[model samples]
Target: MSDGGDEGDDAESDDASAGTTHALRPLRTDLAPVVEAVEATGADAFVAVGDRFDDDLRYLTRFSGPDRPYALVVVPDGASGDDRENGADVGRAVCCAPALFDEQARREFVAGARARGDGEDDDPGDGEDPGDETNAHDGVAREVRTENVGDHAGERAAAAVAELVDGSDTDHTLLVPSSVPHDAAVYLERAGNELSSTDAVTAARARKTDAELDRLRRAQRATAAGMARAETVLADGEAGEDEAGRPVLRWEGAPLTTERLRREVNAALAARGVRDAGNTVIGAGPSAADLHYVGDEPVRPGETVLLDISPRGPDGYYGDMTRTFVVDGDGGWERRAYVAVESARETALAEVEPGVPAKTVHGEAAAELAAYGFDPNAGEGETGFTHGTGHGVGVSLHESPSLTGAGELRPGHVVTVEPGVYGPDVGGVRLEDLVVVTDDGYEILAEYPFGIVPEKRG
Candidate 1:
């Protein structure tokens, strides 16, 4: 995860340089498609208002500010005849952010634009440097100007957004995402501008850029490390008898509970510079049947132990991977379930090429499970393939291009390919891998072993 090399003898130096290098190489986001989307909406501009939690806004501005409200307004290019004559095909953007986040916004937004030479010739017209707080550049094809507001930043930012729409002479409609804050939408409407909700941002975010892919790969590598740590612990665990005279997994003379295993996995993720994002699922035996279970239970030997880790990286990208392991198995239900799930995973992954309907992937996985004698249509509280094959992963752990949805797979689409089976009486078996749709096929982001037996790493 440390950019593909050993930290070397001077760990401190490596850490310091890592931050420096990361700042220098900002993630490149293309806004041209978003601009075209805005134009297609028949709206003058696209306005998104939310805090850092709003993945749509974060995707547009790449500014990871605090939980306070911020706004971004995007206007399509060639708004004027002169601009069209000059061949300006990319749209323009403005970030109405809180005054407190000026520096961070400049570093994340303006600096990236400057690095990409996207705003070299643009004049701020305020005598301040282009990188100044008043006007910053966007690395995308468009020119992004930053406007800092203070005191009641949410309303003030909404007003700034209104001004952006009002300033345009020929256009007045403001397109916003459905997730836009209610107050912001109301303010925009009261400002005499018609507001419409559009899925343009969500559609654009489904396909990632090269830089985004790099961040995803880094996060997944960290996730794989976390899985390795958990697997190693499982491999090192000794078989022992519990107080009830039942078999239990013990590590270092202590019972290895799901909570303790999760801690070990999380620690490994943190060491690799990623946070678990509260999605690290470690379940054993009957608990494994409860898909999203986050409980602490005994890890009995010869039972299924499902580990599903989805961690978020520093750049706000997520990595998701799941693997099931069984210790001292007697080749019974767990083994059969593992084989079926692995086969279903392969069937799902093979359908991950561009232009393929996302639902086809899920159908294939389901069919494979059914072929293995597991009911693909098992209802709630019943055992079999119980969930979708996978979902897209990015800024939000689950985003667009869902495998169970009607959307078609496209290149640059990063999605998980997880096929799982569950039964309360036996347990669960799941195999997952993060993959990105490629021009011809797909590429698995990380490679980890697949087996019922946990593998130990040095």
Candidate 2:
């Protein structure tokens, strides 16, 4: 259930020149509806303490960075006809960054705007000259300005919020997302402005734009490639006797461990320019029954191997998929469980559509599982089907509007439909697919064939 993150000290990057390109929809177009929603709540401005890891902030600003640079962006309301239409007024979407990393912030800010399909041509000098701060975004409806907040960025952001509130009524509130740091929240609250959580901002991000879908598609393609590699290794594994004279699976004259399979999958994903960010789950034998187990034991033939890989692409969007395969599997309970889980996944996916309650989707999968003689509630810990049917996937591997419970599915909502059953004696069987909710149905992103065993390639 938990995803992995990069280890080591975080440092700021060199300058604007170190920036990388990302695919994005127009920033203003994405934020317009969000701002309107926030404004309806009586809030005058929306603020997010953004970084490369902040998906909500990245959705609004399109400013993912190479540096772990913290930035604050303020979007105020009620500027002009065009500005109101676009949500934030042009040149008023204020971005504040540390003085040392201001150039990187500026590069991300402008790159986001330029990447928008509706925006004018990109300025060739955007990266070369970071000092020339322009109020206009050139081709888009709104503009962004980057400023250095000096030493204390949070205090500066509070002051900026104070300025916005002062210009308007004294009752003006600044909307912040749930990820805002406690100290930052306190500073903004102490600055005489009311602080509020805006679900609108985060909810807006659950829906994928066309540009986002492309990145997700590419990411899933890479994930499918990794799955093929893992299955290949499993297929090539040969039955043998271990040092203890027990049965085991060997690949290339060596015992195949879960860690070895995981490494192989990771290598394949890395070759495709995708990183797992620690959500790669490779478990085999009885360990697979634990769901989250990253198995370390030597794999044995005829035991189920559950491989779940959710890798993030270069564009920051994530692709999640899970499949179970048997190493020259024993044809018995494993085959039955695999068929049940696969059927449950299909049942759940068929229920996905705009306006459908998420709980209904989960119910469909559960019903299918139960129909196949697998009860979701009968298992204590490692029996029957376990966990939610699905969850939203986007910039973050898991997001809001879970398919396990209430919440209406909408178009642009991308989610994972995973149905599984586990038992200590029989290992586990699980099938997961990433899909986008459509008006009438859903579009599957992970296109790899769902097979219980892989055929050796020519």
* Candidate lDDT (C-alpha), each: 0.76, 0.70
Each candidate: RMSD: 5.4, 7.3
Q: Tens digit of lDDT per residue, candidate 2, span 204-295? A: 77888776787787788778777778888888888998899999999989899999989988887777777978878888888888777765
> How badly does each model clash, as a count of residue pairs?
0, 2
Clashing pairs in 1: none
* Over 4 Å off, model 1: 1-25, 80-89, 115-154, 166-171
Q: Report the CA-based lDDT of candidate 2 relative to the real structure.
A: 0.70
Model 2: which ten-residue window has the lowest total lDDT? 8-17
220 in model 2: Cα distance from truth in Å?
Answer: 0.4
